[model samples]
Target: MASESSSSSSSSPASPASSSSFLTEPSPPHSPSLDATTSSNIDIPVLISGAGPTGLMAGLLLAKMGIRSRIIERDMAPTPDSRAVGTHARTIEILKLTDKAVYEEVGSQSWRSESMRFYFGNSLVADIKPKPSNDSEFHVPWMLAQTETVKILTDAYEKTGMGKVERGWELLDTKVVEQEQEQVEHQQAEDGTTQDVKTTTRTTSWVETTMRRAIEGTNKRKGESVVLGTVDMAGEDEDKDYEVKVVRSEYLIASDGGRSTVRHRLNIPFPGRTRDYNFILFDGHVETDLSTSHITFINGDNRHSVGMFPIRDNRVRMMLDDGTLTQEQFNAREPKTPTKEYFEKLLEETLGTLKLKVLSYNWLTYYRVNERRAAEFTHKRRIFLAGDSAHCHSPAGGQGMNTGLQDSYNLAWKIALVLNGTAPQSLLDSYNEERIPIADEIIKFSAKTLDNGVYQGWLSSNMKRMMLSIVPFLVRYLPNGRSRPPFSMLGLRYHENSVNKAHKSQHYPVTGPASIGQRAPDDILVPFTAPADTSVPRSEYLAELEEDLTDQPIPTRLYELLAFPGVFHILVFAADRLAKEKDFDCCLVKDVDHYQRIWSSRWPGLRGVLESNATSEAMMCKKMKSTPQFMVHVISSATPSSFESDPNETTTTALADREAGFGKVYIDCEGGRLHERYGFAGVSTKKAGGGIVVLRPDTHIGFRVSNVESAAWVEVDEYFGSILVN
Candidate 1:
């Protein structure tokens, strides 16, 4: 009840418990900054509907990219219930870039649980912890309530001047106000001639968004004053609270929940079933006989199917079946929000002698699980759907809120780039192409887990029962695949995606461990100290360094290099000292210069600017600023000693780091494990080694130049050339 987490479990356990275990986390800094934008000036670059995790996260991320967005919530405030509870690894990685405190706050307040125990009444059925620690930053998954997460995200978002959630607003109507199509304007001759002149004008497409104040009397309007109360001045029961405003924007994002008004208005079909099987979920103080550290699923052959977790403040979160409630009893609870008594009696009877007393209930919900997905995610490339609007499913794996946040993430960068005029408009289309299949996968996965009552279906309880007897045996031979990278979503791929250029000669197989389209793993790096020079500003030299990171076996992490302003990250994993020296002499030195020469010097016409005879330093610097900025992280297998020893090596590395804008140099000299992990199998001097890996702003790999040669740089040039204007 105190924390927020979208809870997920690895085992189905003949029960769909949605319970989350959490430690008491410190509350967010006490409203350090109040929301400044109280005016109803909804005119912004991006307007986000539904201020849930998806919308809040979208607004925050867009702000990081210097894009301002107005997030509108139909409700007056954040959700009181613990909606989602599990913060997976990839999500934690993403949050660390935005604000490390969120990651730390969420992690501290939640229990890190790997295995969940299942019992049939008092009898033990299976104790299963399918996933194990791998390359993830956090070894085990952290569990915080979803509400706490919302507060952290919301506070962090509000702190950014970009936008804040206008809690009293709701989407009333949306339409294509303008379309980017040619229109012919006909004008009669001034002399009244028989012929008329015509001019063709091209109009850029945009959406006209109309939103009304759903909640009464809490909005500050900018332009015209509308009715402020539910009752009008006449008191004739007219809907006086309906204050509507129509604003136009280049794009609109619908992060609205399952019954998304934006999705409905766009005519996107959401096809799925609302299962008859209903469940009662409640969070309250429970005196129970269970471990306080882990999630337990008390389940079995349709007898006592329940899930219990120890949450913050000595309270517990529990979920169980509807327990044969009559249709009359079910319908009695108006709005489907359950009563406290409905859950107390059920918990008492189910626990029997286990001693579970629900002293007080914080929130109660009766939900009929539904698995559905929108047929498409975007409309006319102007209006986009995300979060529950795009895809919704039974909360089996806690993928709902997490996936929604990810949807906002995947689309945010593309929108930023396209709007920045660096990327082609077609880049926006990849959001649908990539996310739909992922939604489909989760929907199928959720259905099987929800119907775990009898074990006949996939993820059959029977299979778990049999596997339980030999779990230790299974763990030995099995790759521990279930709870590993794939389960945590760190292994998600978009290699077959149109936006990715990974199938070329140099790029490794997308299926490889750290290949194209996969979440780039975090690796440790040792800092190389340059010669003490009072002239060089050390803090500003490694200026891109993040403020939040603390102690470690190494100084910085690979993921930290990623959380910058929205753009591509080109990591040139140069080989060892001698090899890098050779590689630098061969071509690494000219990579940035080549792009600069092509984009700035020769191709000024690409930017639609007239060729200038004025080529001063300031003029060239201004011209260079216009091109797409891709951060270059040159990670080498060499140690600081190498650069300290060789003058040529020092000069090359320094030139790349400072003069050429190749990012900070990081060392991974410990057997080059990071190099090997990224599919650069070996990078010794004798070996024909090293390659280039390109990562998107969202940290997904886009392409790789595996063949690290002088000529191989052209492939990279071609990759950016296709999508970027210059």
Candidate 2:
């Protein structure tokens, strides 16, 4: 998909006669199905407005969680314009977890930045190189056009067996409705006949949306703006020209850009100040004396600045800010649609002594910067505002699309669990609690970056440039040594809530420092069971196993093991073996047993626990599914062979295997390196030495306890009980 559209002023006007012709026309190819557009309504699990990156991601996530969704877009095709040009590390991580193949495809086509170069009057000021991400393989932002991102997400969503995006559809009106429903139950009699047992009345809440699509060969308004309060006959004719469709959905996700009609319809107050900064942006091929390998920011006379960000090949995204407009003109600023030649001259003027020439161009856009966020992200617990609908800010850090993608990542799972009856509706509150703060942070960070970008003879701007020059040296002194910048979004953490618990709840001193609400840190681990190769000799395989696996060149990461969708993963850090001990329980076997039994029995129907009396061998032969709510993995500092106790003393417990009810076993065989990373370095062989870490569906550290005692296990159960349904 092309990420550039024609100038904003190129929209064609419409006549009244064309608008009323819809009455006699057939449904167009992009219109919704006839049944869907008729008087009768179509029911869906989730309805998404706008098929942009955020909406498409929400659809994909819901599908991964076993829920279906319908995405509707007003545009007949994906917008040629790309409002966002890159995705940060956090967004890429979410995409990788959602679908690895899609992540690889996007990453392969994106351009990775090497560094950022700042210049004042053609004199280089700062050349800052990006630091690698400590927690993820994707360290920097992957510079890809937003149109390409939407295309990839759309393809992934369709492959989920969910329906495709319903194009040429506009949300006409939407509101929450309550209706009384009648449900009947039947019972089987002794004669093997069905009998009506009971009838019940229940009140259900749903979002009822009225959708509209202009009938082809009619006055569809083209791209002309239509005022609702106008008295023109053409407006009246256009009003009733489109086909009306009714949609009933349990939830609605509005990702429909900054001019969100849904947000306006809901009367949600969008509060923020619009800056006086106006700029013209475009993507094109450029021949220049300066290097294109890095993102370059140039400041010229009269406060003019130009930013050149390399895309692919020789093309670059040029953002030129003249900074010449007066306060009053900026206050009443409208979009400026100048020709390609105009932008070329402006770029040369901003470049000063630096020579550059534009050989070809894609598209250009002119607008002032506006930083705004909706007062509320959710309404009535049924309607949600995501992406640009929730917040909009300057694209200083290339954070517009990345932040929106993370918003969907945070929202989709909560909605899925609630709809599946596994979690309570109150869980939905955390979406707002967790994401609004992140949005605020992004808004503030981007505003600061924009304000301090160009020199313009401002002391503050020059000072900031000087500070940026030494960022590489300054980061080395900070904790974690600046693997990723804060704008890359790896440093954001959620505040303590029902979902993100505080460490003080646990009396044990297990979790070192404090990371309960932060991203679950990553480390290397040796799997207890290695990948098998039949061609290899048994002796060679045995030899390889005997060697320290963690010392091998390529080690498995903890994130790879927690990549399962919509499930909570519990990591039990069981420390080393004690030769004096008779059994290999590591003082955690009883705790693990109680955790397994309670999880398997508590929410039988809700957890999707498959009841089986068959032996472990039979279960393995049948390939039975694991419990949906929880997955447990035990990581021991001891090697697999260490679990075999001395037979001469006593054989009290079974070996650490699936049959022994210890979940899947993994080895932290790096001299407890992985254990120490989680603050279990010099643990005693008793119960207090090890701890439990719970990874939420989004891979954030939801909860942690110091010891594997019954009291700790009970607290873990209570954490789940607070958010999950009865």
Clashes of each: 19, 2
Error of 2 at 382 (Å): 0.4
In model 2, what lDDT does residue 709 have?
62
Each prediction's RMSD to truth: 12.7, 8.4
lDDT tens string, model 2, 40-79? 2336868999898999999988877777889988788776
lDDT of 1 by residue, 64-105 (tens): 666788888877777677767777676777777655555677
Give the best candidate by TM-score. 2
Model 1 lDDT-worst window of ten: 13-22
- The CA lDDT of each predicted structure is 0.62, 0.68
TM-score of each: 0.78, 0.81
lDDT of 2 at 247: 67
Q: List residue ranges in candidate 1 displaced over 4 A.
A: 1-42, 123-134, 179-201, 214-239, 300-302, 323-342, 453-462, 472-486, 531-552, 577-586, 596-628, 638-644, 647-663, 686-688
Runs in model 2 lying further than 4 Å from the true structure: 1-42, 179-203, 217-240, 324-335, 476-481, 503-514, 530-553, 577-590, 600-627, 637-662, 668-686
